[model samples]
Target: MIQDITTSIRTTVVLWLLTALIYPLLILVIGQGIFPAQANGSLIVNDQGQVIGSTLIGQAFSSEEYFWSRPSAVDYSIGEAAAPTGLSGATNLAPSNPDLLALTEERAEILQAANIAPTADLLYSSGSGLDPHISPASAIAQIDRIAAVRNLSLDDLQTLITQNTEGRFLGIFGEPAVNTVTLNLSLDQR
Candidate 1:
């Protein structure tokens, strides 16, 4: 019984050190060395060298001149940076729920007031509520409004949208979508 107890103690200590210390340290060093930008959080900077947002996270854009991301349930009242702003979750409201229908109608009216026909996606939030990307169709749906507000040509805006549109992963998995944050950043360049 003493021998068994001793062996268990020794094994536990060895495994704990390997998992809690050595393994994590090795991974951190390797990750930082191989992918510094990503390891550092994939931050995006503006022309003045201010951190704007991260490529891996979504930020809210409400300006008519800017392309908008999916409606994030996360509150941005906490900070200037949009990433890591608030907890992400869904409405979880059913299709027939009055609240869901009311929210959709409200969103549609907002777009219509701007004279843009909101797409189906624009009416509903994404699953994560943190999705930075929107379907190309959704982006295209708002082009006219954005162009009007920004005083840019429709053709140029269309070209910009086309340029930012990302195909499905390996042309198979996931749907084709455009990162609205990145797209708006590019628009700022214009």
Candidate 2:
């Protein structure tokens, strides 16, 4: 019985080392070696080399000069106010919910006032509320406003949109998306 107990304890220790320490360390080494950018949170930097934000997460852009990201339930607070609540989730509001309806209507009105078409993406927040990508149509709808605000030509804005548009995943899964964070950074560069 003592020998059996010793064997079980040794097995547990070995398993714990393999699963908790060795496996994670191996994965970290592999990830850092092969996919450093992605493994490092896909962070974006500015011209001065200051880390701005991550392409994996969305940010709130309220200025008319820049294209807006998807509506965030948490307002894309990031490390500001949302730090306490953790990150990335939906409001889980049902379609029939009155608050959701009011919010949607308000968003639609804002788009209409701007003379921009209220596409589905513009009117509703994404499921994660942290999506950094907006639909191509949504991007296009706001081009005129951005061009007018930035004093840029419509053609140039259109070209920028085309350049920043991302292709569908694996050429089949998921729809094509435009990364708003990258797009905004590119605009700043230009």
Candidate 3:
């Protein structure tokens, strides 16, 4: 019937406007007004005020002087040619997969070569492949290497780690983690 068709079209338009435009605009205004830094990617800046990176994403740090982040399946490429297609996610390789085993072994070998024992977070890429935080244990495990490379005392480095460690959400949720990006930046300052 014509009435039914008219009602249906009107309902569709109202719902579309609410979801596709008005709702998102409301959220944007609220976000920008309430949390401007987080609304704009939570970017970290250097002493010169250049945008170095975002706190929400991980970056690869191969330097022995810095604490490393979790291994990323995408190698932390956002739009680079290395990972032009996607930004995050696991390799999805099963534990029994030969490629997974080989990669794990290779990571283990690299850690052993550096005299640093590999932790779970170091050996395996996180599910998102973009986790910026590493386990407290992982950060502690690298203190000796970082201290040696940076010519800083081990006790000083340990203190820095303690200072930078972020506690769990509401003191109950996820495990404590250290933001490697922030930790490295703090090291640079020191």
Candidate 4:
């Protein structure tokens, strides 16, 4: 019995050492070297060089002059930088779901108040609650409101949106999207 206990302890020590120290250290070094930006959380900085947020996560914006990001269910309460809980999902509530119906009505009311057209992206949240981009249609839906609020012409805002819109991964894997952080930063510059 003692011999078996001693052997188990030795195996545990070896496994723990490898898992808790050596393997993590090796992965960190490799990750830092190969994917520095992602390793650093894909942070976004401003002209003042202040770190605003990460390009990988979405933030809520309620104003009219800025382009809004997707609805984030995370709420950033536990900690803004913490890995969001899996519960932070887009309700997945169907159109007929009472909660979804209420939310859609509220969103539609907001769009009407802003004199803007509503899009599907604006009405729902993404699965991860951390999408950093909006569909081009969603962005375009808000152009009139943003333009009117910023006192900029619709044509100019459209140009800005066009410039900020990014194509798919190597033109195939993912859909095109506009980065809300970049778009809002550009608005601040203007």
Candidate 5:
């Protein structure tokens, strides 16, 4: 009985060692070689080679100088604890929900103040609250704000936006989108 128990224990130890160390190390090696950029979180850098941020996560840019992303459901909080809570959805408040009505009014007022025509996409938060792209309509809606702030012509701004718009993947999958950070950075170049 002791011999059988010892053999079982030895087999378990060997399997655990292989899985806990060898397997992970092998995956790491393969992944690093296969996708170096993605393995490093696909960080974007400016022309100065300074690290900006990852392309995968969304950031909040409220200033008119920069094109803004979708409203984040994250409450725009930082730190790990900001992991999203509740349903990943709009508050679904009724039209009669005073809070809902108030929020809509506030957003509309802000848009009007900036001379921006609000699009539907601008009013909703993405499921992940970390979406990095915005609908082309949303980008176009902010053209006035960006152009005025940069002192550039509306035509030039629209052209810049057109240049930055990315088509659907493989020309079929997913919708066309504009990366907010990339487009904003390109705007500075113009």
Candidate 6:
């Protein structure tokens, strides 16, 4: 009985130290050394060195002159949260839910008011509610509005969008998408 108890305690302690201490320390060391920028949250900076947002996260841009992120479940005035999937959650509403329909209608009206064609991406919340990218088709649909509002040529805006769009991983995985915050930033720098 005594030997069994001693062996059990030793096993528990060994596993605890390995998992709770050494494992995390090892991962942190490897992460910091191998990918310092990403380890530091993939933050982005501007010309004056001010931290703006991150490449891996989304932010809301409702201004006519800027492109907007997909509708976030976590709605707020400042718009989308900056941190990767920060404070995100789905409304978990079923497709036929009346509240969902109402919200979609409201969003459609808002887009119509701006003369922008509303797409599914505009009406639905992303699974993560923090997706940093949107379908290229969705981005394209808003080009006219952005062009008119920014007083920039449609050709230029389309070119800019094309430049920022990314193909799927290894050119064959998911559909092409455009980073919302990055596109807006690129627009500003131009």
Candidate 3's C-alpha runs over 4 A off are 78-86
Decide which is better by lDDT, 1 or 2: 2
lDDT of 1: 0.81
Where is the poorest 10-residue window by lDDT in model 6?
A: 76-85
The best candidate by TM-score is 2
- Full candidate order by lDDT, most accurate first: 2, 3, 6, 1, 4, 5
**TM values, all candidates:** 0.87, 0.93, 0.91, 0.77, 0.73, 0.86
Models, CA RMSD each: 2.7, 1.6, 1.9, 3.9, 4.3, 3.1
Expressed as tens digits, the lDDT of each residue in 6-115 for candidate 4 is 99999999999999999999999998999989999899987789998877777778887788887666653236555453335556667678987887788888877877
Models ranked on TM-score: 2, 3, 1, 6, 4, 5
Given candidate 2, what's the lDDT at residue 13? 100
Give per-residue CA lDDT, model 6, range 46-111, as digits (tens): 888999888877787888889877898876224345355348677899999999999999999998
- Clashing pairs for model 6 are none
Q: What is the lDDT of residue 167 in candidate 5?
A: 96
- Candidate 5, residue 35: Cα displacement in angstroms equals 1.9
In order, the Cα lDDT scores of the candidates are 0.81, 0.90, 0.90, 0.81, 0.78, 0.85
After aligning candidate 5 to the native by TM-score, how far in Å is the CA of 37 from where it should be? Answer: 2.0
Clashing pairs in 3: none
Identify the superior model by lDDT, candidate 3 or candidate 4: 3
Top lDDT model: 2
Per-residue lDDT, model 5, residue 60, is 80
> Which regions of candidate 2 are displaced past 4 Å?
78-80, 84-86
